[model samples]
Target: QSNIIKAEFAEIGERYNDKRRSEIIPISGDLSIEDIIADEEMVVTITHNGYIKRLPTSTWKTQRRGGRGMKGAHTKDDDFIEHLFIASTHDKMLFFTDRGKCYWMKVHEIPPGLRTSQGRAIVNLIGCEAGEKVKAFVSVKEFNETDYIVMATRKGVIKRTALSMYSRPRKGGIYAIEIREDDELIQAKVSHGDQDIILATYRGKSIRFNENDVRSTGRKTMGVRGIRLGTKDDYVIGMLIVKREGSVMVVTNKGYGKRSDLSAYRTQKRGGKGVITIKTTDKVGNLVGIMEAIDDDDLMLITDRGIMIRQAVEKIRTIGRNTQGVRLAKLDDKTYITSATRVLKDEEENEEEEAAETEEE
Candidate 1:
């Protein structure tokens, strides 16, 4: 039996003695990943109920953002797209939770499906701790110190940290910030550290301050206050970094909104009581959202009732600081504006002109 085993081994060894070689043979695992996985462009849609899905990018090529996006998701009536972003299948998506921890996943890990299909729950794709929910996320292709991440809390705390710090995260998730028990991270933005930071509160108050006011800090520290809340329930509802000059539009729960010039909001010391950015009353409800807008920028406002309305900023009627300008959306009872964002900084006029040209043709 031993002699038979040794003879078998010798036969195997002789077969590979550089005598068996083929010029056309290929190396193992050398196949192109693009071929194995289609590298086509994808459209990623995230709904308010923590659902995320991806469709082919061509699905939205001709459809402008405010022009009634092709039913991105058929979620519960209560759900809507709170955060929407674009990334290639090879990009990395970083999910920052309310608990101040972040989870990272490749864009392709998100399953691709029909535009109307309800997406997989975020919690099922990424591991989130109990009671933790995704508040904001950034799709990053490269992490560099040249870029900075500006984070704002619901309690008005603001922090800026280097983008390079998040280049490598642990599999179990790492702390993005040290948040208080009562405060949750509400906004996260990528900036170059020189843009102006705007914080709008729920009670129609807003403050614009230099981004340098808050010193860049490490990941484990609590941020400095950006806006001082007069009441316990008064928290920040909107935050954004602007590089260009524009008005800050404030939208209320009753769909009342107005655009006030940036010149109207004088830069003040951080943590001070903000000036009255708009009027709020028992009739008009508290402010629900805010955005930096130009005269020609097209803004999209979505309500909790699943209604999306788009209008040019010029049509919003720029007004003084202390007035509720006009009704942006006529809403039913109990329905309020959930989120507002600029669909395009400038392009509505161009799109309209092109449409008119086509009509003439």
Candidate 2:
């Protein structure tokens, strides 16, 4: 009655005052795509053949060190696990391909799967070309203009571009780096434009160079050589953007791994043969992967036979870069470590869960 005008009181008779047919409800505001999707922790896994999927983080239970890990995926004879990382469903995922192109999508856009499901082909999701292979997957919360995208190729080429340059991506992907014939992009990292970039080779050689050493280039240009390969067979295996505090963790094919101090790798000129990272011999084998890891991080090691073991980084021995690392995973002769990644400590996840519960309340 208060909302009605005095002049309209006569028009509002018994029929007008009848019971309302609909209820008036209120909403906070318009909802966005992200607002509808649940922001939960997800485990993202990519196979060597470019099959990708995301499963709930609780799919795998924590196991003690040296416990036989469960089979992570069912792959064909030639295909195997290539990459694994944990991220939130709301996070942005950057997919860098060996063909020097980059694609962007939200983590929730990836096909969801169960523990034993073979994932959808990455090519089908990102519209990759017939022969293009996704070589690296980076999860970022936000694309800050001040940050930079650092990319490395198997032939030791490295490029740095402003992160804002890649803020807008196309469905078919855009050129990230110009690769010469026979050279392919190995991996990419998002840096703050002043951190150190480490390029690790399969032959146990690594070169640490500041991100500033390579001049920032446009998206479609070829980068300068960041390291010199000893031979054609000794290509770059992994790249790491490191800070001053954490150690450079390197894992070998034979399940041997170690964490070397960041101080051991002095910043060197780009294009020089790097210092010895690990002693690659008949026993320890060649390097499989390397990462910037801290004591609180959990290391996820995957073998070529689809076996995955999550070991605490602190359990791995910290030694000089020139010596062979201690045994991180016991492997049979037929199985070898293919790739490794880090899972942050549970404190962060616990905090996120609590925050979500609060929001729900």
Candidate 3:
């Protein structure tokens, strides 16, 4: 054995003297020479107690294998235990020790337990990538209050839900319930008291006008007195005249008992009492009275301020004939005019003219 060792050592030295040209060789032995010589890259091995020992030219490898008598078992400085246990990502690793206490470690923390199948699994799972899918089947030796299984992604954050912990498969994706945009409801209000009364030419037969239906342009007051309906007063009373061609007619009360007749005109009477015709144009007497000398359409309300509020011609009071009233008419220029007089029944003539015009058109 001594001669064999000497011869082997000589051969090893000759083969490895030139570091660049040296070849690695494995050998088994338990022999001591003053200084064992071999190729720098050579590896020597010895077998004993079912364990294999390897010797290399590097001191780092020797230390890693637990230098000298520390063979087979890792030394206190050996990091294999820690490297085998620590997670590689931003997650925690959990291990159940034989003592029943749970152990936890962060990705870079040193591991404390002997490497086992369960320990390996825990380490791998903790270092998984973000959004990585995982399925786990684990058994606990004993219940530990502090031992909580945190289901986290490789990112180390667990999704918060109403139930158990989970992680989304992908980041920045739409949620189960998407957020909605803001919406609102709008409404508009119109005050009848503020709207101005414009002469509107409507085609219809005998529409009735009521005080309630007629909106007041003038400020609301207890009663109609010295009031005007339309433009400023510039005409005489009892004379049904259209101030302007298209403008509404203005009827002024000249004196007492001088009533304007709008019988030829159409009119609508809304709310109020009495069938008084051409009554005195007293400032306080009657602002709106039923016509007695003309048809209902031929009546209008003569304001104390001399502006005539023309009743629409399409509206006719249901009251009898010979009633004094006014009827509203739309001229070719779309002007509203009120004609006051005794009741006139000329529907047939008007219809004939309408038909002729239609035929011509």
Candidate 4:
């Protein structure tokens, strides 16, 4: 009886058509594993301690220039949102770290939450070293060789690499720029190679040079000096790359900020003693950041105390290089503006007719 059962099983196994059946597959592989959250634009925020989240474009009602914005984040006294950007959920965000490595992710990958709620840790989403901190990140639809990412360091070093070099990123990330032990990567801006670069120093000094001055270099190499620091206390704080339009904005920690005409900061050779970009005074405090923006752009100011204020850049008076800037944000004894970024004009205008209808519903 045992021999007969074994023979029957063997005959059944041999008769099965395993080869042809295994080759059959579905007609289409187009089913999406990720949700479609790209219908609306989002405002993403990254705190100093690496907490990040995204909110809808309609999070804060638009405000006029100089009108202190609504409190946008509830952060610890020591932590504040250091970076904020306007991007579509479908766009890819290339997170660049201080160690010269980068991690690529989509805006949708960042879980959506309220502005007051601290979101997930960015380091977890994009694997990074223990001590590595994000220095700069940019959003792009697709990497193209026509555009370049110009990076600057705390020691006044600058490097430019083609965007195509970062098209393919890894789980562990790859080299974006080389840095010495004593220096640190500070700022990054995307622009055409023909644009101009404005490097602002801590002590209210800045230099404008043609982007062509710094030739494109490899991803693993260090760059040449973009400015000559006037004092040991002064380090490069802001690096703005812009074409012929827009004004250069200088903001101080004490809440003083002003917009200066780009033409006022005449183009100079790289690595020179930059002219006075802002007059630092006891009341005005130290220069904290600089931005390339126009009157139409909306300014988002983040205080070290975690307070965020959104105002129009047009409200801030455009002054000269030697003048102390006007009050861009009102500050208290222990609070002051730390970092600031701009939202484009079109992105801020969310088709009022549609937004009003949504809110009414």
Candidate 5:
């Protein structure tokens, strides 16, 4: 009788169900990967063979400019570190290819590795086509209206576009500039609106012009001429933005380099024959790279045979614009310098007497 009575009571309770005692509150959203990751300053390097990796800034010990840098990466005999920079993990890196396309990614997304490790291939990170190769890249924390993206081609063409225009990114990459049949994009730099620009050629000529001379254009337009190449074989090797204070350092394929004041290179019109930057004798070889550097900066030299040396900028002699520079790297006859870049000093680090000759993999 009791069981029957309990069953009847349960059925009556089910029929008279009340509202849920606990409240079901909706949450704002889920946590994203960027939100959980901490932003850090990293030493990022990309090799000519499309390998890239990021290591902590502490991986490099500050050495007096002119010492062989520690082995930055375990590169193959045919490959070398073409690009090394310090960037925050949260910054966005915009990569421009030789085929005139632009790809985008965050710096933190790069794989982290040890100092001597060969990095992951860049093809696995970005959407690059079969024949396309990355020529230049710039890191930006925020795109501002007052800034511009300046680009230069191997055939001496230059283009400027508003930085805000590239705020949006596409999957396969969009055209940053229209490349011609025989020309390829060589350099891309971020510039303030009012600074001067320098274009250096392989035959030891450089032209300096104000940024205002080049009119801003759409993403797909071909740029105007920045310099007049003397011969079909002569092409632009590098482009640098000039400031009021820093000196422009020019390096040759035979390991010669020198620093000349910004005042020595008089400002010229956009499309004129440039002044001689260095005397190109058989001793110095052709011009290989140019960079804007200061006394406190570090200079990185990379050769075609995958050797790299890092030295202080102050050690290089400041010479006249028309003279041949002194030997910057002791290179063999079969090897020649291929690229040069400047690294700003990190204030928090302590300087060591010398860097290790090699790093363990």
Candidate 6:
């Protein structure tokens, strides 16, 4: 009865063309007493015209051998697998073309062990946009040599020196500024205020204050008086000195002895005839009408008080002339006296000269 049942089942399989139970499967040229199952791993070949063709296990090898299975599979003419068979577990898809172009797509989630055609169909149904162009290779370090030919469209191609800082404008804002160094952004901010000045030290410490706090005593700019505190006290306005002869002398406005008490005793000395010589302390020019004395180049006042006094160079000035009332000679580089004339005595030498003439022709 079992043999009869087997014969009846075989006849039924032959009539139905069931290769699973048939003795010989003409497609793969193999006997299949058991069921002839399709290969679990099925590859979908996509043509250039976007046609998908599914080949079974028996016909897959033959189609591959005939160079007609996959669009870009096993070909040397730059025709590579354009479509990737991504499983549902893959969150990222990496695709490479025969022409060396690469693409990377990131998906939120993928379905499980999905068929290639079904995956492609779902991808088309989702209508996702193509990813940005990415480099086929990634470099761990920066390329330093200039000899390398750099592609212009490559990512992270910069013209700045390594680790150099830069100030750039921020996006979506007009008043925003960004500082970046070595392609990394930094933190900084700037603002405006009143007429305040900031003083920064070499050590990076700074002090800021308004103009009033730094104003000068003279109501001038703080800079006009300089940063020193005692500059005002050092400024000399006038000077006064008393001579030993009970005469008072004062100097002001770069003039010397302008207000003198010796006007009544000008031509007289205490116990002898005397003359007063007023001269500028500076040797180069006259100071306050006083011709510069040869010895006192800066400025000196000689008085019958039997005392010689020198005033400050800035305060010394020429005042007037000698007793003869002649203007004193202005002291300069070119003025010099060669000689002084003196009268020769002739009465005592007349008899001696006559005797000498009688002795000589």
- CA lDDT of every candidate: 0.81, 0.85, 0.26, 0.82, 0.87, 0.25
Query: Candidate 3, residues 65-132: lDDT per residue as tens digits?
Result: 21232222232221111111112223322332211112333332322222121122342423434432
Candidate 1 — which residues are off by over 4 angstroms?
Answer: 1-41, 59-85, 294-314, 331-361
Q: Identify the leading candidate in terms of TM-score.
A: 5
Ranking of all candidate structures by their lDDT, best first:
5, 2, 4, 1, 3, 6
Write down the worst ten-residue block by lDDT for model 3.
183-192
TM-score per candidate: 0.77, 0.71, 0.13, 0.71, 0.77, 0.15
Model 3 per-residue lDDT at 27: 62
Candidate 5: residue 241 lDDT (0-100): 86
What residue pairs are clashing in model 4? none
Shift of residue 205 alpha carbon in model 6, Å: 47
- Give Cα distance to truth, residue 151, candidate 3, Å: 99
**Per-residue lDDT of 50 in model 3:** 14
Candidate 5 lDDT over 117-141, as tens digits, reads 9999877788799989888888898
Residues 187-232 of candidate 4 have per-residue lDDT tens digits of 7768876988889988899998998899888788998899999888
> 52-124, model 6: which lDDT tens digit per residue?
2233333334432113232223422222223333222212232222122222332322222222332232224
lDDT of 4 at 1: 100
Local error of candidate 4 at residue 246 (angstroms): 2.0
Best by lDDT: 5
Candidate 2 to truth, TM: 0.71
Q: Cα miss at 267, model 5 (Å)?
A: 1.1
- Which clashing pairs does model 1 show? none
Better of 3 and 4 by TM-score: 4
Off by over 4 Å in 3: 1-288, 293-297, 311-314, 317-361
Q: Which window of ten consecutive residues has the lowest lDDT sum in model 2?
A: 344-353
Please tell me which model should have the higher TM-score, number 2 or number 3. 2
Q: After superposition, how far is residue 309 of candidate 1 from its true place, in Å?
A: 5.3
Please give the TM-score that candidate 5 achieves against the real structure. Answer: 0.77
Q: How close is candidate 4 to the true structure, as a TM-score?
A: 0.71
